[model samples]
Target: MTGFQNILTLYRENATTLLIVIVFIFTFSNNYICKILPLS
Candidate 1:
């Protein structure tokens, strides 16, 4: 239970950073991959 609580606390603290990272990855793949690769 303590370990689960710790994980939840860490997630709450870094939620914004996690969201930004996810968004950045999605954008990078969508824009760069489409532009560089032949298939889109």
Candidate 2:
């Protein structure tokens, strides 16, 4: 029981980190693409 709980906690932490990284990359690429294109 304790082992399962530990694994769950670890997974949650990793998921949060992954979500942050994904969001950062998405925002960075969006801005880069917008700047490259003349969308005014």
Candidate 3:
């Protein structure tokens, strides 16, 4: 049971980190693309 609980916490942490990374990537890419698009 203790090992399972540990895994759950680790998974939660990884999920949050992954979410942050995904958001960062989207934001960065959008800004970069906007800069490259002069028609916008």
Candidate 4:
């Protein structure tokens, strides 16, 4: 039970970190593209 709980905690922490990185990447890409595109 203890081992299972530890695994779960680690998984949750990693998942959170992954989500944050994904969001950061998405936002950064969008901003970069917008800057490169010429405005009408």
Candidate 3's displacement at residue 33, Å, is 0.6
Candidate achieving the largest TM-score: 3
- Candidate 4 local accuracy as lDDT? 0.97
The TM-score of predicted model 3 comes to: 0.91
The number of clashing residue pairs in each candidate reads: 0, 0, 0, 0
lDDT rank, highest first? 3, 2, 4, 1
| Model 3, total clashes | 0
- TM-score order of candidates, best first? 3, 4, 2, 1
TM-score of each: 0.53, 0.86, 0.91, 0.90
Better of 2 and 4 by lDDT: 2
lDDT string, candidate 3, 1-40, tens digits: 9999999999999999999999999999999999989977
lDDT digits (tens) for residues 1-40 of candidate 2: 9999999999999999999999999999999999989965
- The local distance difference test score of each candidate is 0.91, 0.98, 0.98, 0.97
Question: Of models 1 and 3, which has the larger TM-score?
Answer: 3
Candidate 1: the clashing residue pairs are none
| Candidate 4, position 33, lDDT | 89
Please give the range of 10 consecutive residues that has the lowest summed lDDT in model 1.
31-40
